[model samples]
Target: MKSRHDMIERYIGLMSGTSLDGVDAVLLEMDAQGKPQVVEDSFLPFPAGVREQVLQLQAIGHNELDLAARLANTLARIYADVVAQLLGKAALPAAAIRAIGCHGQTIRHAPHAAYTLQIGNHALLAELTGIDVIGDFRSRDVAAGGHGAPLVPAFHQDVFASDTENRVILNIGGISNLTRLHRSLPVIGFDCGPGNMLLDAWCQRHTGKPYDANGDWAASGRLHQSLLQQMMADDYFQLAPPKSTGRDLFDLNWLEQQLAAWPALDAADVQHTLLQLTAHSIAGEVRRHCPQTQSMHVCGGGAHNAALMQALQQQLPDIRICSTAELGLPVHQVEAAAFAWLAWRFCHRLPANLPEVTGAAGLRVLGALYPA
Candidate 1:
């Protein structure tokens, strides 16, 4: 086994979000204070065939554990491959990697039914990489009566907290979530609403592109006011804090139902409405809870979409909008990097879940640990 300290205690964080585009691996080196410094980052594209298989599961009616295991094995192969490549990019040997923080593909997340499933075997990851792996991050929190989503915000507090300034670290990933961080309080977090998931899914279906680059496609089109209003009417938007959701609630089905009455609209118009919906839902939540979260620091792929960012800025005109990069973390690397920080807490038997955020019984170590 590699000596944890001898290995630099550098952790790798891997995330494959609902967008199902690729695997993102972030390398974080912790200082003596346990604060993380981003060492390196890389994303490995999911083979088109693999993505197709994953999406196809959305249509299947029957259940098959054997087939799911097959997918899991293949996925772990790519996951470990991604971890290896990211470490290589950092010019570090695998032996020096202390542990990996992996958020596996979330196929279904329904806390209402007391269940959420994320596939990618931690044991397989440990066996493949010969490094201790920390994953299945959401399950422990769920079992403890938390939403089991937005776990990244706990890590965000550790990395982004400021003593003199209050910060709202809004992560516009597949699902939009915000961490309202105050100087002297535990970070508050919850899933805000749709992020890239809807926009990307819509674009892929209509144009074959994986996502709307900079939301330019949406910018070229006009928002259908009625459709936009109806999309915002989802009950999920009105749910209080301590809640989370997945594609199950805002899937293509939900969009189709809302748009069915107006099938006469142009594809571009539909695209425009989807983008507006994401920005609108998130903006409303910020205004409702953290009215004084005037300094908003955004991180994730959605932060790079110029049109969406512009829309958000207009909604909160009095607030400051900036990317996490401006705060020393890259937009693309924040979520994965948060997991890296979470693993650091896990290794020390420290609590990572925020009860104020996840409604857990209390703070607890949030992931299962695997030995190197």
Candidate 2:
């Protein structure tokens, strides 16, 4: 085995998941298939009007390809600035980082139709930061007939696998997904549905905060049974595994429609229902797909929300609900670390996608390599 110092290479990970709330950047060091030691991480909120513009383009009421392209450039600029910030904080030069692993801002995530787009151009990120960049981490899997999502399971397996034990790794980003890893089989994963995506939007609409703190707003209100039932009826929930979805399927309009059908319900009732929808859908999917999932280890921003965690526990009492913390990783930083691992895989020319999970026809190397 390599010495500890041999694992001390620097790498930066940049991510803007379906929530689109902000950018998450992290610096980490770890050997291949080893525990990542986080050196530093920071969240840079999108500019005041920036997130809204992306949402407008994502929402039902817009026509602006030009706007998206410009926003892409702006996002890359922000990424570059953050890299500078990271380097400054770490007391390192640009040359120190082995690579910049970027998931980018997902503008359109439609894998079934055979194409997906994540802005924040790697070309620009590479040029501005003077660092090698790896991105576009999903398309090749889609080309192979996979869901092109829940891409972190491979990394999770690498970092979490043991000699003779099983684990379920749940990532609750803008959308929620779970990775069930075990010895003697191909690792598998799938999207469970909205995580913080709907909850964050609901809170912003009602209280002006970016998100519901621990789902406190949801706790203040009660679920609107009508809306809950209607939302639970969504066909997406019933679709088989090997499925993937994004803001395109579950967004403000989607949530609003479920609310509109039950016009008499208060906004709090709507918020309460949304939270239940997230928790229940996730628990239900895990039960359906990974019944052997003994313990569910959570990650992403939503894992810290107490109310949502409580709701999930109520739905799946048979399974233990825990954070990635219990598994030796921080909840908020797992996805960020995922891209870092993806970059490592790319640098090694290793296949980063699982065909069964992404619906890919075969093992494929995901992500494009951009030179410094």
Candidate 3:
């Protein structure tokens, strides 16, 4: 007879990044050694209206409290639907899953002010899915006096670290973050300025597409060196580690402000320059911090941008750069799966946040659990 204790415990990780694109969910299984194996992954893009509302809520506006609460409920339902789809695809019952690790949509992340908000009602999700839900994973870290952003480096260390080589796990979502991994060193990580956030926003405005596919539009345009230099001089890029950023600093308004100087520049040229800014900012951090890095494994939406990849390779010719898919996990699955690993850690009462990466007072277990 199969005993409950001897059965495999499954966890679902849900993430909706700053790109405001949509939800990404993944079902994961952990081995006896605490390594994660992705069982299934799924993505559901936000409706245009929903996406717009979320973007609006990023900045202060009238009746935002009411709007944010309503949207949180809507996101919970959306998350529940994704959970249902994952269970159906895997042929598993809700009871078979231990808990879900959900990194809800980040409408605001102000760690310096001592708060970070991610809204997807975990209690409602628990009731709707009939599975335990663990969420609000960042607030506690912020309470511990940490940035509470870029929480995936600990997961990167667990899954991608190699004893024989120094590696950097670069996740370029709406915002880019890199984890510096070495066999004998503490993990170092921080946001690498903007990633697909500015590019996607600019592309959507000019091309009407959510993102620039394969950098086709960017390749069609010319790179403006002056604009790139001006953007690269932003204070955020000059800040030391223990830092993080989102739409709060690198949104459409910020981009427009930068473009205001060059009133006659081509839109595609602006986009091309933005792409270079992302590549340059990321490369600058790697060269400054992880100079000994042998290879950089990239994941997230930016991994698909050929022009950006070429620019990164050009900037750091000494190191090898490739998609994280080369390392066991698929490019899109890394962030979602990291949340699942976080849930597994929470279930075991283990500390998941890296003190070195997030600058917390010390190691701490993240997330709040809502039982089914």
Candidate 4:
């Protein structure tokens, strides 16, 4: 007979971040103590057409309702396919997993409006996968007077907190965010600013690539001081914590507006400046709020960018910076694993949002379930 700790409980987590790149799915196994380990992982990239459609839906567009609903259905199908692949890789039936925590594609995130929307129909996902699906993880927090963004800090505290060393978990997806984990202080996190969002947009427009691989294009150009300063002057950077932003503020249109003043600037230089902007914005927040953070473990697509990583180290010479891989979790797996943990919390009826981090009136159990 196996002890309670030896019994394996499984959950699936699905995440398609603001990057508009793809969905990451993971099969996670939890122990009796609620500790989770990644047993299997899979990724499904969005086709260029689907990626374009999602980006188009970010702003108000033609036939809004029909387009959104149709795209939601499409996303659900993609999500179901990912679940199928995960189950196949694990060689297990859907009945073996308790639920899937899906952080749907976030097209609009306006916390001040007291609403945030992430597409991908959970009911459809459940119907297709034969597993309970937990989604819409942000609305409850937003309804509770919180920024329903950066819901990963609570999960970060659970899995990445250090009792002996002050640590910060930095996730650089389409939008960069940081979670400070101090031994004595409550966990706090907020979006720092543009991560790969601007970089990828710029690279795609100039180089026709989705992103500047390893930030080599940026590394090739010199940083334009004036352009960098102009971009940094936005009011969003000066705002206090308990605040969050998305493409709602920092989109390609916003970047174009910034560049309207520098019509003749070189594309590589702009890319370099954008990379520095991400690094500086993130470093500024870490210095301002987590002054004592001794180590920062990075997780997300941005971690794989060598140029950006070097820039971060240069921004903070005293703090050690490394990838989450060093901590036993790969860069790309962190966010997906977070959703898995969030699903587990929801299933257990545990409050998964940190009021301190999201500025909710109080803790709230996030994510609504769609039973199969």
Candidate 5:
């Protein structure tokens, strides 16, 4: 048998975030030093009808269990397809990969209830892909009285942290979250607020496009300060660290309800204000928690929004801000890669969640494994 120190393992990570945009898959190799090297990756767009069904499930609906289960199976099939594509592109066999880490489609997250659900049939995925699968990464942390989110911060510290300067890794996915890494302080992370989720939903409703490409639509209009203030008043923003949020709190219905107070606002203005809400909320959290942050690195779809980036720059005029790509990981791949790293931690029986970050009972290894 090979000695453990000489062993190398490969993992595949699949992430379908709250953006409801698509699935991101990545293949990575972890060596003895616990460094991950990305081998290959791909993005598979969700089927249009499936995406609609997912969005609908986010709210109260009839037959939701049935709908969620059906969506889980569909997502498994999609994940399997993406895994196959990754294997072919990387020229690796199924047996060569140790396991797959999947962050399933999050339909409802109520960590305060000590329950958060992510649906994707990992057993089915393992069966179809002929590879072991590891999933349900959030529940254990939640069970231990943790928020069970912003889990990626642990991975961020390992891969992106700097020892000389304070840095913040901001992941602007459907919902934005940040990881605070300082040379002297312990790691801290929490959900900042809305990211591309609101912007994309508003863009689709008003312009029929899935998202505000390059944030052009938002840039074409002026910000509505009053409306922005109303949206920012959400209670989630005022909470301290050990927090996480999702579409359950910042969805289209919530936005519409907030807009009820300002009935005459233009659609473009609403989009612009939504953009500002994201920028301001994120910057506010950064200033409040990591005021000494020397720089900020962004990742996820929101980094592609030029106008949003510019707004963020304006909000944090003193701190340097840029994409995670500058640190060797592309904006889109950071989350997926984090899942891959989580799988590595699982296989090694290592603790993945930070007690300081998630308020878990203590540090614990997360995720359950389903063997091939």
Candidate 6:
């Protein structure tokens, strides 16, 4: 570990996951050996109106092109504001930061259709922040016949790979994804299924809270086993590797349709079942693909949910499950840190996407740069 006195290049990473809650900005410093150290981080939730607008645009609609463009600009302004705040907190000027790796809000991820859309006006961000910006890190992988997601597995391998033991890095954001790091086998990863998206949406619909704090609401309810079985019957779980999914497949409408089959169920019971759905789907994927995984380190907002964590541990009794904090990076900071690492990789022209995980044509240096 470098002392506070060590001078290192700083990079900024901005991420807004599918939960549509907010943007997370992380300022990271990388040493000569390519290890990343977090300098400072910030989280800014979206305004109520902006979050509603984003939710509306998640599907096909009238005048979507115009709305998307406007939303992108709005999101860019928010991102720029976050950049300013991060720089201010770090006591560093914009010039001190080499570049910002911005994972623009993913509006659509349809790799099967050979395209994915992540919208944030990088040009505007660069102009506003007075710093270089790298965005659209997934399009190249999609163009190369890949899922264009779970992209952080490469970063996980770089930072969390262990020679002494097999490991799996699980990121439970709006969507849950896992990366398998074997001591000998090739790294494997993919989207497991819904993470906090369904649970949060349900909580918002029933309790008016943004999410189940520590999953207390979910803990208060009883798990409806029948409902969970029906939910697990979804084909997404049984699909083979090289697969990915997003709000398009697992959104409010989808849940409503599933709930329709089992009428007269309590809302809290439904919330409890949704939580179990997330745990079961994720555990099932790990068992099928990386059964030999010795340890699992979870990250993202879902990691803070004590009930969800307990459910995951119950589902995978043999594997040691814990938050990424044990490994150094905090749960909420891992995704942002990965994007910062991506910016560092882009600066060095290093390949950031792993073909095995994304099913891309080959290793590729992801993202496009917009100079300030």
lDDT per residue (tens digit) for residues 95-141 in model 2: 98889899988877887678887888789999999999999898778
**Candidate lDDT (C-alpha), each:** 0.85, 0.83, 0.91, 0.93, 0.92, 0.91
Leading candidate by lDDT = 4
Q: Of 3 and 5, which scores higher on lDDT?
A: 5
**Which scores greater on lDDT, model 4 or model 5?**
4
Model 2 spans with C-alpha error above 4 angstroms: 1-8, 30-36, 59-63, 183-186
RMSD per candidate (Å) reads 2.4, 2.2, 1.3, 1.1, 1.4, 2.0
Model 1 backbone overlap count: 0
Off by over 4 Å in 6: 1-7
lDDT of 2: 0.83
Q: Candidate 6's residue-wise lDDT over 1-372, tens digit each?
A: 776547577899999999888999999999877879997999988976988888888889999999999999999999999889888898999999999999999888889899999999999999999999999999988888888988899889988999898899999989999999998789988999999999999999988999999998898889888889988999998898878899989999999999997788999889989999999999999889886888999999999999999999999999999888898889989999999999999999999998888899998889999999
Score candidate 4 by TM-score against the native: 0.98
Model 5 Cα displacement at 28 (Å)? 0.9
- Per-residue lDDT of candidate 4, residues 1-372 (tens digit): 898745878999999998989999989999878989998999999966998898888988889889999999999999999999989999999999999999998989988889999999999999999999999999999999999978999888888887799999999999999999988777899999999999999999999999999999999999999888988889999998898998889998999899898899999999999999999999999989997888999999999999999999999999999998888899989999999999999999999999998999999999999999
lDDT of 3 by residue, 41-122 (tens): 9988887598998988999999998999999999999999999988999998998899999999999889879998999888
Clashes of 5: 0
Candidate 6 C-alpha RMSD relative to the actual structure: 2.0
How does each model score on TM-score?
0.95, 0.93, 0.98, 0.98, 0.98, 0.97
